[model samples]
Structure formats: structure tokens, C-alpha cells
Target chain A: MSELELQNKKAAAFVSTETIDGEIATLNLGPTHPATHGIFQNILQVDGERILSAEQTVGYIHRAFEKLAERRPYNQIAPITDRLNYCSSPINNMGWHMTVEKLIGAEMPKRVDYMRVIVMELARIADHLVCNSVIGVDTGALTGFTYMFQEREKIYDIYEEICGARLTTNVGRIGGFDRDFNKEFITKLRAFLKEFPKKFDEFGALLERNRIFMDRTIGAGPISAERALSYSFAGPNLRAAGVDYDVRVMKPYSSYQDFDFNIPVGNDGDTYDRFMVRQQEIRESLKIIHQALENMPQGDYHADIPSFYLPPKEEVYSSMEALIYHFKIVMGETPIPQGEVYHSVEGGNGELGYYLVSDGGRTPYRLHFRRPCFIYYQAYPEMITGSLLSDAILTMSSMNVIAGELDA
Target chain B: MSEFATKIKDSILEKYNNTSYELDTYGEHNFICSKNDIHAVVEFLKNEGFIFLTDLTGSHYPESEGAEFQVVYHIHNLAENVRFRLKVDLAQNDLHVPTLTDLFAGANWMERETFDFFGIIFEGHPNLTRILNVDDMDYHPMKKEYALEDETRTDKDDTFFGR
Candidate 1:
């Protein structure tokens, strides 16, 4: 036998021997199973259809992003952030940019801030649509998944209009956007805003009150609020457990304070509650997007930080000053302060924090991404310890543990 | 500083003696304590309503004398909306700190990730195995001494790539 096969056999023997009851079986859920949304392996000890205990083995897609960030320059690191939680790449991009901006103390213009808000909220909707609809698919309702995926495509169209990329969007810059939102982008966004709610409501109707969906998700993977807090749950997961703590409200960044919205909370921290909380959040994100668009300011979209922000391509080709500035930025010659800063944004998943430490170098001395998926995935085995095997799949979908973010 | 932060800072200073620990308000309120007293400080902070362990990770500084590895903790009090950082520095020879798993269950994987990357031993952790890396990987990849790229990859050699 191969080394891996022998090791697996030994592990299975060890697990079988450890079981107290007779006829207990061990099952490997995946590093590549369809039910496991991403590449994560869960070795579950089962007594028939019920799971006795589960041990998760992550890192199949570990990219060593933190290690890689140490070699790349500050501005070039934005593309790397895009790969983490690719479902909402813009939020990751904006969070990293805002972290660098925080380190440099660059005050962004109101127009730039509002524009960022709109983009972030649209990304939020895309993230929630995938999460909620996938939860439906895991519960054996695949129609909602297909229906909401079309709306997700519409959001992708808006993203393409903004940054010319669909999925792993390396959008925005350190100080602000690379370019302004054009008339076409605005028109598409308006069309998306007009059409998405009806589709969202219809999708909700398909799964919200359905008897089978309710029974599958209501108490299948329930966790107490206190336990959830101990696990450092954030975003919709924590909010679903009745905690009103949101990074946006707790520490508002990128003009989030100006937007009026409500923080949705749920009494029970279960699959159904998580689904409902995200559903309500989609509505709130829509409200925020509408507010951001209505109150959009008329001024410079990109911040006026010449040392950090790149000059226009047209100017770079003609003007000597602009050419020099462009060359300086592209070469990563801008001076960085020797200090540390922690900036967290209300990401699609949760509190996406960037802890950056600089030593007056071109590259970051050390950078850590506080990925929420990683934090909450730790609580999975604990939450689903006594639940059924089928329920575990439902719980995994509800957690929205993006493998990239979890492993990064 | 806000009253909430000040109260916690004062309590730590008064209890530990101000000279024993270094305190600063650089980004977040940072308290650099000895590795020996980290558990006590965490316990004190937990009792002081810093119930949320937001993040726990390690950073390596090869040049810093006597402080080779710094394990930083970002703790938050949800009710008070206050967050502060606590750091414990360890030398190369003694790279061990008390585990916070007893206080916060989430610290299990965080400590494992730290141990996996930087090789900082969290004493008293239940299962301190590598979380994000393969089990057989030998070296701590995040330490400053380690190169970011693989040396064994011959495809991207300088001669072939024309560096």
C-alpha cells in the first residue's frame, strides 16, 4: 500500500477502536466531495446516520498569502487579497487598500467613500445570494440556487462595468478607485437595483417557509450565543446569535457611518437563523446601496495622494511630472512609515481585519488577514458534534466557509 | 483614551507594577508583557469584559534582540466597543507561552496556526498540531530565516528564466 493509504488505514483502525459502541463507522466527507462546498476534509465518526464526532482537516488550498505578502510591495498586495474569499473580492480589495490608507493617514474624499460603499454593498449581495441559495441546495432545493445565480450574474455584470473582471476582481487602489464609474456602469447598477429585489423575494418564497427546508435547518446545527462568542463569531454568524456587534457599526470605515441602516439579529444561532439573518442583510445592503447612490457626491473619485495614487495613463504618456510619478509608484519607491495598524471592515462573511506592520520598507514587514471563515470554522466540529450527518452538510453550507479564506 | 480603555490599563499597571510591563497607545492600546505573565494578563482582561478574542497570531523579528518571536492578541469588549492588543515576546531558546484554550475555545486553532507557522509552542494546548500546513512539513515557514519560495523548484532557475 502507498504511504497515504497505510496512514488512512491506521487512522481508521484507531478511530474504530476508540468507539465505545459496537458497529460504529468512520467516513471521510471530503477534500473533493460535492457536499463540501470547497476542498475541506472532515473525518466524521458515525453511528449509522448520526455523527458522533467530527475532526476537520483544512489547508488543501493553503496559498501562504501572509508569507507571499512579505515579498511583494504594498500596492501589489491588493491582487493577492482578491483571492481570499473570492466571492466578495471587492471587499477584500477595499479592506487591504483601506488598511494601507490607514497606515499613511490619507483622508479620502466623500465621493470616493460613497462610491466604495456602493461597490462593497453590491459585493455583499453577491456573497449572500451564493451563501443563502447554496444553503437551499444543501437542503435539497436546487431551484433557488439556479434562480439566484442569475441575479449573481447581474451583480457580476456591474462588477465588470466597474473593474473589467467578473469573479476574482482586483478592483480599486490604495487611495481610491483606478477610474470613475462611467455612465454605463451607473445605468447597469440602476437596472440591477430595480430588478434584484423581486428576484430575491421570489427566491426567499421558495425556501423561507417551506416545511422541508424549515425542518432541515431550524435546529440542526444550533449553537448557543455564549459559545458563539467564545469562538469569536462575527458578521452574519454572530449577528444570527443575537449579538449586535458589527465591525461597520463598532468601527466604521470608508464613510459607513454616514449610511443609515439597521443591524439585523436573530434569536437562535442555527442554519435557519443564519439563512434568515443573511436574507435580512441583503435587504439592508440594498438599502445602503440606494442611500449611497442617492447621496453620491460630485468630486474627485480617487484621493489626491500623489505619492501613493498613480497618475492618469494619458498624463503619464505626455507630462514629465506625471511620468516620473508613475514610474516612482510602479517601482514601489514611496516611503512607508515604520508603525503598525489594524483596520477591519464589515466583510461579506464577517469582520475582515488587516493587521499590517511596516518597517519603512517597500514590502510589509508582516501582514495578517483576520479571516472570519477561519475563525468560525473552528466552531464547526463543536456545533455539529451531536447532529446528524446530513445536518452537518447543511451547517457547513450555512457557515459559508470559503476554502480560500479558511486556508489563507 | 476612553474611560473603558483607561480603567483596564490602570488595573493591569497597578496589578503588575508599571515597570514590569511596557504600555503604549500607538495603534490600539498595546501592553507588552513577559511570556510568563501572559496567561494571568489574559485572565485579568477576560474578567475586565474583554470577552472576545478577535485574533491571536505570531510575528517573527530576527533583528530584535532578546525578542525573536512576538505573539500578539487582539481582544475586544463587545458591550463597551473597546479593543486592545496584548503582546508576549519570546526568545529563540524559550519559544513557549501558556495556551489560552482554557479561557477561549477558539484559541485552539489560532494557537495551532501560530505553532504551525512560527513554531511558538503554546504550552497546555490539547492538540497542538499543524492546522494549515501538511503534517510532515519540517520547518516553520513564517520565520524570517525561511525563504518564501521553494528552493527545490528547478523550472524557474535563474539560468533558464534569464533573470
Candidate 2:
């Protein structure tokens, strides 16, 4: 058979009869598989197992968060934000509420603001811990994952102690927190802080010097700073490319300006660079969390607005006004002013923003989430272009491409 | 404020032959520009050292008369530490714009998302297929038109497990 005949025969095997040639064989990764993370499908044009091009087919996890937020009231959308990056629900909670608050010209108390910063930073640490640990596991270092999971469990325990829920924490209300942080919560946080640094150091020591781990990650998924920037990469992915662009420092939402911490950047912009960046960021998050917690202001955790923030149970039962306001806010009776605002906060992934438009009604006119995973995932093929299949998995795991965030 | 964004408003106005650019500053060098003349405007910005196309997305306003889709871009300049947003509005009928993928290689998924949600067509986008929807589905699920009948229906039908 001629070269053209063999090419035609190979093309016919694919469901979509499209073919590309560059001395590479074609491969399909997954539409359904555990390692693919979620329902993501990737069609790779390969040359001797070296991927020449990788076309990603996502939407396996699309929940249409933007469309759903349109029908729900500003406050009712908190739960929806939780679902977007389900791994870091509190950050999404804070991001969504803060965006709405900015739209409504709502100013939270200093204490409430500081508390939000602490919670958000904690969430960032938790997310990075999961990301780094998973990358280790993907690279055949299972012990690191086990060690990190122990610490993450402690963090989740603190989350449960503070909010009642572990993963899907609808913790933040519109104006402020759902409630105050008690002494027990503070004590647990302090305990976690005391032990966390040592555990982080141990985890770092376990993987940082391991030759196998270093070899697997060092040059894998190397993207130039210019390429990283153009790809709209945010969080550790962008930071790995040597840019000091952090939303918290750049914009300073939720009083992130009050705390002082350095934004770590990597020189090479590879899988190893991303790993180091995330590792350093986790340390920085701890610093921010500690500073915020120590300097936490002395004031009401919830905002003074009776209509927006839920009233205390005592006030709810005693006062008819409180009862009525509670019913009104819960039932979406409060009139939402017409306007639009784009609010972006530095999430575990990168810049997690909520672009909200209101139409003087209870429900929103529009709600669009600028998700980091969606942007970072775009660079997957470029990162894995000349690398092995295992390198692709390590690169993806290092990037921490959370399916919930990507598909949202 | 970063150098690139500080002079961006004046530069944009000058480059576009005196077209007024609404340059709203958020933090240091964060500027938001209106969608009018955005493609040409961004091309100039990219050439002048604001090379990073950090984010691109779309939001829908059902109440607005004709102008429904609003696409936003978050850009950064690595050398200058500048960040900004460039927004362009598209009507339902004229939901087309030139693809920025030529300038920013990372815009592949973001443009697909903008296409997925608001149905904004990128004229030069390579593969503008349904990214987060069923290949056979007709409507853009992110629009207000595709409202769900029940809350539970979302859990069973819209995501990976959706039929």
C-alpha cells in the first residue's frame, strides 16, 4: 500500500475522520478513566509515543454555573459558587459574596474582613497541599500523598469546627460570616498552625531530594514566561513562569493589603518549577494566615446590616422585624440593585473572579466565573508536546487541574 | 502603578485616532477598557509590551435590550507587573469577533468557553466546538434561554453523568 492509502486507512479508524501527519501515531487518552481526573477527553497526535499535538475535549463536568446564578438571588448563589471549585468551596464562597457586596456597596467590619482573609488563605493552603501531594502520588511517591492527606484531614477538621461542613462550606454570608469564630475554633487553628510547619517541612524533605521525583518533574511541561502569560495562566502556574502577579497583592480584596507576604516565583517554568512555587506559596499562605489571625480585629464578625446578614437566633425569635427581614432575605424578597461588577480574588488555582450583573430584581441578570483551571488547562498540550505519556500525567497533576474548576 | 497600564488610556486614545477609552484603575496598573475597537486596541497593547492575555470570559445580561454578551479579558505585562481588563460587547445577531489566539496561544480554551456560554463566534478560532456541552445539544447551556426545570435535574443531566 502507498503512504496515502495507509494514511486513509488510519483516518477511517477514528470516529471523526480527521488526520494530521508529522511522523506521529494517533492516541486517545480518555473520555472515561480515573487518571484523566474527570470526564475530560484528549485526542493526541503522537510521534513514537511523543505527543505532537493534544486536543482536549472538556464539558464532561460543566454545570452551567453562569446560567444557574442568573435565576438565583445574590445570597442564594453562594451554594452554586461552592460547586464551581468544589475542592476550595470557602474561597468560592468568599469570592461570590465579596463580588455581590462590592456590587451593592457593602462594607464589612474590619474583623469580618480579617476573618475572611484567614479563611481564604487557609483554603488556599488546603488546596495547594492537595495539589502538591497528588502530583507526588502521580510521580510514584505515594508516601508524600499519605503524609499530606493527614495534614489536610486536620485542616478539614478545623473547617468543620468553624463552619459545620468540611468540603461544601457555605461559610460566608453576604455581609460577613454566618457566625462568630469561637475560642474552640481559635484553639484548633493555633494547634494546627503549630504542627503544620513541621509537617510541611517533612513532606518537602521527603520529595525535594528524591532523585526519581526530581527527574520526573524537573524539565517536564516547561513553558516560557511569555507563553505562560499569553495562556492566561493564574496562581502557581503563572507564578511558576516567573511573574509576581497575585490578585491579593495587585487588588487587595478582603483586606489582603493588611498582611505582608511575598509572592514566590520560579525561574524555569516547568513541572518542578510549579511544584516549588506551590510549595513556597503554601508557606506564604501559612504566614498570611498567622498574621491575619494574630492581628484579627476586635469587632462583630457579621456586618451590621440586618437585611443582608442573617440575624442572631435570639433576635430572630424576639423581634418581629428580625423575623420579617430573615424571611425576606431567605425568600429573595429583597430588591437587588441594577449594576454589574467583576470581582477577582486569588484562589488556590489562580484568579477566581465573579462577574455579576443585577437588574433591580431578586435574581441576578448575569453571573460569569473567570475560572483558573479553564485557562491553565489550555496549556496542557503545549506543556506535554514533546514529553512522555507519564510526563503528561505528572504535568497535569502538578498543574492541579481540578475537574470541578475546569468544567465549571 | 505599572508603567504599561499608567499610559494605556492615553496610548489607546492616541492609537485609535482619538477614540475615548474608559480606563478605570482598580489597583496599581489594573485598567478596564470598553469593548469598542477592542481587537485593534489589544493588538496595539500586545505590541507595546502588555503581552500577557491572562483571562477571557463572557457574561450575559438578559434584561439588557440588544447588547447581551459582554466578553472580558484580563491581561498582564510580565516586565512591568501590570494587569488590566479589556471588555467587548457583542449583540445576539453580531456575535462574532476576530480570534486573539494568533497573539496569545493560551486563549484556546477561554475563547471556547466564551463560545460555549454566550455563543460569541471567534472568526479565526481553530476549533470552536462545544467544549462544555453535549456535541448534539443545540442551545448554549450558559445562556438564560436554557433554564432547568428543577434543581435535581442539574445533578443527573448536565455534568459528566448526563445522558
Candidate 3:
């Protein structure tokens, strides 16, 4: 407590002080901070470290993906989809490809349909793991996060075993998986199925009754059904608000109607509800994966249209027709009949939709992605109102705002 | 079908099935109404308890002479547990529509995104600033005509690309 030390501390505090519209308190919370969950900046109008109003400033990672997709062929848009929700690329890939399929009237085989269901459910589980674990980390329970990340890493291994790359897995071709699943992949997934439940249970027990975590989350960001729907919130965020409107159940795309599972609803519609709904969804996804594996049909993985998809290399070397078809698909010169289709799937986050338009050309005439995160994150301020600054991190993690998907 | 979606679609069809607006039944609950009746139909849908505006998106056809844009609005009714589609068509030059933020708060950012990509303007949007694009950027990136000219086109501040 020397005079020089006290003055230096006072000077440091004074240097940090600034005016915003004549009001003197302001604080910058991350373009680089672990608590941000992603690369995002929030300029907070503050009063003694208590947030008055938080103005979120994003687009630090805006890649202009929609513009990039306009120039590329509709088939090539799969890679761009990979970038949107980089945490769950398979879901985005399948969603974008399904839109194209709907436009062209392309029918995938029943086996491929089952395979897609399995992979997407696995992605859903992984996404929930991160959301749930990060909720724990934000609430100061690092042990719970370690348990969940281990299960998530197992899921990532399965993804890598299925596709060569783990994170940005551009797994699907335009119609179906680029390659068929082997026995080894199935064995690894079954092992994850057995181990995941135990880890999930242990993590749940650790946080569900933890007084501090519950206090932070229970009523932290309570939004009503009216507000949630009006904000265009989707996926777990909307479901957690007691909407009971799962797009899979409401619209039933990709033969999701055939799968039997409950759409878990949360009555309170708070941060705790959002977290709980996602946790419940992990079990539901496991159920879907089990069913999909059991009921998988035996047939071709891709459509029989050789001109649109590549022929086998053996056929290409042996037959002139196969070579010609190969050349056409590679050049993206294969003609698609002119039409438009809006295809949507219940992504782990929300409704991941693609509105595709074609002029019978190689490239998409126009492509618009109805990203759920963008809509949900736009309403972040409304959710965080009257809550402490720390609650912002918990609210974001509960809502699971992936910046890639939100910005795209 | 829930009475909410059915009555709303029937009411619109009964009232505005004229030269300007064409009504096509896409599914049992889903009906594709013409662009002209979009404002009226949306108002009816909102008043009739089909309040949740789930999604608003666009599709473009370059070959079409005047009509190119097909915009769809997916709506839901939480009370009745039903969903429906409302649609409008826009000519290439006049890609403008009334903002739905008055009806649904969620439409604000969705409309801004639609504007950012398709270059369609919402007539009465409160804050119609770019959500994804920087304030300085000019081109509507999602329009059919906006193409990637070169590698330098990736840079956002160097707006001189394609110039």
C-alpha cells in the first residue's frame, strides 16, 4: 500500500476509462478471449464491470461464402457448406446436397438414406457434447468438460475413420457418401455407443445438482415461446423454449418420419432448459443411430445417373461411355433440369436449409442458406438483458452460437 | 391439417384468387400464394394465429425474362402444431417487398441477409444495415450475377476487385 503503487493503480484505472455518447463507462470483451467461444467482439456499455448494454460486433470471420457459392457449380457448393457449421459439417453438407437433390428430383437409395441418418445423428451427439461441456466450463466446472470432450473425441475418431479428415469433413458426394462404410467404422461407433452413455451420465451427475452451475443457468436467459418463435430461433434453442416444434417431426425431411424418437421440450425456456434439451437429444440421437444401423437397406449408395456422378475408374478405363460420363461430371457440364427447391433439415443447431435455383446450368443461378444460428444470435441481446456479463457466456454456450454458421 | 393453416389458406384463396395472385397448393397445409397477395396473405396468417415466421428465403432463375426470383416464407402455428409456406415472385429489376418485422421480430435479420445476398430491399425495415457484409462493401453477393472474378476478390476492404 505505498503511495506510488496506489497512484499507479489509479492511473491504470483512469487510462481504461472512456466515454461513449457522453456516458463514461465502456469495456471491450474479446476479439480474442477464451470465454467468447469464437472470434467475436462485444462492446459493453458498463457501470463498474456490470454490463448495462452489450453491443455485439461480429463478421471478423465472414468469408463471403454465399458470394463464393454463386460462382461455383451447385455440386461444388458442398465444400462451402463444410465451412458454415464447421463443428457439424456433415449436417450442413447433407442439407445443401438435399436441396440440390430436391431440385433435380434425384432419389437416393434407402441404404444411403439410413447411412445419412446415422452420420447426422452422430454429428448431433458431438455438437451437443460441446454445448453441454462448454456450459460446464463457463459455470466453473472444468472436470465435467474433460469428461465430455473425451466422448466427443471418440465421436471425432469415428468421423475420421468414416472420412479421412476429422473436423471439416466433406464426406458426402452430391448424391451419397463418396465411399461406403466398412465393418471397422461400425465397430468403433458401437464402442462409442457403449462408452458415451457412461460418460454422459457421469457428466450429468456432476453438474445437474451442482449448486453454482444451476444458479448461473436456471433462470439466466428466460425467453417465452412467443419471443423465441418471433426471433426465428430453431433447433434446441427453440425447443428448449417449450415450442415442441422439431422440424424433423413437423416437416419430416430425409425420411426422418420413419424414425421414432421423442422431441424433448423444456417448460421454463431458460439457459438451463437449452442445456437440458441438448443433453436429452444426445440420447435420442443414439437411439436414431441404433435404429438406422439395424434397419439399413441394401442397395446402391449413389444414384444411377452416371452423367451427374462419376463412374468407377475400372469402368472409365474399360468403356468409352464411362469415360465420357466421367469427363462430363468432372467438368460439371451435366445438365440439370431447370427448377427450384427449398430443402430443410433439422440441424443440431436449428433448421439448416438451402434454397437452390437452377437454370439447367452447371452452376447455381442463386443459392440462399437459411442459417439458424444467424437468426438465433441476432436475438442474443434480448436473451441477455438484465443478466450479468458472465451470463452472456453461459447464454451463448447454451444457445450454441457457432460463429461460422451465424456469420454465413 | 390444423384449422389455423387451412382457414388462412382458404380465406386468402377465397378473397384474392384473381389475375394478380395465383394460388397453388404445394401440400395439404402448404399453399404457394402469388407475390401480389403476399402482404395481405401474411397479414391474415399472422392475425389467424399462424404467427411464427420460421424462415424467409429466395431462389433465382437467370433465364426467365422478367420473373426470376421466387421467395418463400415458411410459417408455423405453435397453438395448432401446423406449418405452411407463403411465396412471392419478383422480377429481376424490382426485387423489393414490404418488411415483415412489423409482423415478426425475427424477420429483421432474415430480411437483412436476404438483402445482402439477393440485393432485395425491405421497404420499411427499421435497421437495414448489412449483418454479414461490411458497411463499405457494395455488391449484393448472393445475386446470380455476382461471380468470383479472381483470387484478389476474397479481400473485403480491397473493394476494387472486379472494377
Candidate 4:
């Protein structure tokens, strides 16, 4: 046969006259698709309604955070961290602060630690609420998403009371918080504590045992514990696989050891298990917040490091020492110790680690963020290979692959 | 160093006598091994219960002659709740390192990312291509020689931003 004829015959085999109507199709679940919550592309090779294979293409929103962190000062980098995993921005801020503190060996006071616990738990609640509600929306249950989003707004209100910003909250300082939790902040938190559980339970009752929801999610996108661990899954996703690995429990930081809670795990490691694990985690986070508020300690909010922490604005205007310190800090002249440290925190999604390498300079020589979503999203193609097209959307929502964190 | 880390260090020292390696501690134990022995050392650590590969990233050191690129691996032993770092330094002229994809499938994109940013080639990566950056770009952006911000912008002057 001629070369052209040979090529035509091979191409014709895939779409023979008999099989043309039932031929496999290629669907570009492109970045602009609505089902993909964030800006990411996945090309799915589907045979009718079933996806035969999937190829993910991320980096649609890569902002190069690691490169930016190397140039910014240690204190200035906290705001940059806020952009990562913006659903739980405060957790990112606190995690970055703790990483720098670890590098400097600065110990925070008990009160500071407790306050951080409260803020971080609230952030966790907000993050999980979004994930679970979005999963509901993806599964054709829109009312629950609307109902839970109100609770997310309330959590944002609490964040606003603590920090001026709501979503990307640059809340904490290097050693501790920039300000104390005010009386209004405490009242709002108490109100949220009093009312959130009832709403959470109502939301849970709506989907937890509903026949249709269960049928849609029970065995959808299942991963074995061994496979999940091999992919370095963390946070609720790993727990859903029955590994029982919680960074807060394993290597406690920011007074997490003092709080009492259970790490929820599931057997099937399916979408339903991931949803249940996050639902259980919401209750656990509430318990931790209540404990933290009740046992709130008495001390300064921020550490007394003039060189690292900025002084009050009034003091900076009046005192020569404060003014010099302010200039030095703003100009990125603060001296950092020559060392390296890796600090991991139990973020809303998983283990959010900041690896810092300092050369006794004003800025970090290298700062690498171990973003959990980025790692876990790598397993999405594997998980969704044999599942249906609709099930892939549910799995993506269940995985909660926040683009900010994934492409950072 | 913890007992497990000590044991791993002793094993590496015994197995690779001619190679130069260093042990450093900051927050976790770090074993900086020679470039050629990284795959074997990581395989050895995996056998030693460091089953979870937590992270894989690369750093650039422009001034460090003969060793300008460093690949850092963070691995953990879940049973003991212990974590350690393994680093292998690569020379600038020869930026090739053996791929870890055969051992841990999660290293696929990370190695691509390392290659994307630092231009450190993972020799046996199944699909070695640009991950985060556009494929047509000629230079690695993360190396120290590149500017942090875009220099082409005329809107924000250096003095205005206090640079």
C-alpha cells in the first residue's frame, strides 16, 4: 500500500462506518468550563458518558509565589502567603509567621497561641464549608450550598472583626498577632459558636443520608489508603482514606496540643467519606474554638521584638528608636539569622509547610511552600480515569483543589 | 539527630565511602548527599520506613561553584512521626539528576516544576516539559540571575516603590 493509503486505513479503523456513531470522543474540559471551579484544564477521553482517560493541565493561575517570597522581607512575606489557599487565608498567614518564628527560635506566649488557634479554627470552618457546599451544588443540590454559604459569611465577619480584611486576611505578625482580639470579636465568635452547630447539623442532615446524595457519592472516586499515602495526601483527604494522620495531632504547633479533638477517618475513601470527614471536622473545629475562647490567656498579643514587629504608629512618629526600627523594617533591613527551618501546620486542606532558608539577610534566600492541594490534585487524573464525566466534577469539588494554592 | 536518622547516616557513610556528603541539622535532620548517590540514598531511606515523600523541590545557588543547583527531598515515617530532608547538589554545567518517578509517582509534576523553574533536568522523566511556565520561554525564571519583578513596566518606577 502507498504511505498515504496506509495512513488513511489506520485512521479509518478508529472510525469505521459501523462504529462511527459509537466512536470514542475527546472532550476538552477547558479552563473556561463552569464545572471546573477554578482555572484549570482537563482533557478527557470519553466513551459515551464514561471517561476513559484524563489529562490535567494546571498553571493557568501561576503567580510564582516562591520567587516573590525570596525578594520580600520576612514580615512582608506574610501578605504573600495570604494569597495562597485564600479560602483559609488566615491559616496561611499564621503558618508563614510560625515558619519564620521557627527559623528565629522565637517562642510565642500562651495567649498569643490561643488566639491563633481560634482564628485558625475559624478559617478551617470557612474552608470546609465552601468545599462541602460546593460538593452539594455539583451534585445538583443547590439549596444546601446557599444555606451553608451564609455560615461562611458569618465566619468571614468574624475574620473581619479580627483583621480588617475578610477573604485574604493578612492577620498575624511574625511572633504573634498584630492586635488583641477585641470585645466585639469575642461577642461575634460567641454568637457563631452558639448558632453554627445547629445550621451545620441541618446541612449535614440534608445530604449525609439522603438516598440520592449517597448514591451519587458513596463509592465515587475511591482511592485506597496505600495509593493516597503514596501521593502524599494530607488533611481531610488522607483521613478519609483511614490513615488517621493529622498534622495538628502528630506534630502540634501553636498550642494545638492543648486542645482536645478527634481526627475523623472513613473506610471507603470516596467522595462521601471526604464530605463526612469534613463535616465531622467542622464539629471538632467548633469544639476547639470553644475551648480556646474559654481558656483565653492574659498576655500581649504580639511579641516584644521591636526589630521584627512594627511599633504602634503613634510611637513610630514620636520615638526616635521606634522610627528607626520602623524604617529598618519597612526598608527590609531587619537582620535574620543564618539558618533553615521547615514548619508544617494543619491547614484547612492538609499539611501546609513553609521551608525557609535564610542567609542572615533581610529576606529569605529560598522559601518553598509545600501546598497540599498542589500535591493532591496530581492524583485527580488517576482517581477519575474510570469514573463518569459527572462524577469527575463531584470528585474535583470533593478534593477542593483551590487554584490559588495549586498554582502558587 | 534522632536514632533513625543516625542509622541512615551511618548506612550512607558505610555504603558510599568515596562520595562526599554532609549532615546538617536546623529544624529537621538534613542529609546532604553527593549528586550521583541521591537515587540510591533515597531508595535506601524508602526501605528504612521513610515511606512518604512529603515534598520535592529545587533551589539555585549562583555563587556556589561546581554545585549551583540543589534538589531537596522531604520524606516522613508516619509510624515514628519523624521527618527528614535529603539534599543532592548538582553542578551548573551538568544539571542532570536521575528521576524519582519510578519510586514515587507523585514526583512526576514536581520534577517537571523543578525543571520548569530551575532548568534542572530529570534524566528519565516520562514527560519532561515545562509545567507552570509557557513552553516557548527560553530561560529558567527561578534562577538567581533573573529579576524578581518585570523590568519592562514603565508605570511603577524603582524609587516610587522604595527599591
DockQ of each: 0.50, 0.42, 0.38, 0.54
Displacement of the residue A373 alpha carbon in candidate 1, Å: 0.8
TM-score of structure candidate 2: 0.88
lDDT, candidate 1, A146-220, per-residue tens: 989999999999999889999989899988998999999999999998988998999989988989889879997
Ranking by lDDT: 1, 4, 2, 3
* Residue A381, model 2, lDDT: 73
- TM agreement with the true structure for every prediction: 0.94, 0.88, 0.87, 0.94
Clashing pairs in 3: none
Task: For residue A33, give model 4's deviation from the true position in Å.
Answer: 1.6
lDDT of each: 0.89, 0.78, 0.78, 0.87
lDDT of 1 by residue, B1-163 (tens): 7887878788887877521444443547888888877899889889988899999999999999899899999999988988888888889999999999989988988999999999999998888999999999999999998887787897875453211
- Kept native contacts, as fractions per model, are 0.73, 0.75, 0.69, 0.69
- Residue A62 of model 1: what lDDT? 94
Provide the lDDT at B94 for model 1. Answer: 93
* Clashing residue pairs for model 4: none
lDDT of 4 by residue, A269-329 (tens): 8999999999999999999999998898888998878888889999998999999999988
Regions of model 1 farther than 4 Å from truth: A1-22, B18-27, B150-163
Name the lDDT value of residue A277 in candidate 3: 94
| Number of clashes found in candidate 2 | 6
lDDT of 2 by residue, A1-408 (tens): 532244345534532332333355678888876676666788887665565567788888777777766667778889888887777899999998888788777889999989988888788888989888888878878898898898888888888877899998998799998778888889989999999899899999988777888988899989888778777788888889887788888778888888889999998889898999999988989999989888988998887887787787889899999999988887777866676677888888998877666778778876778888887887787678656788888888788888888887
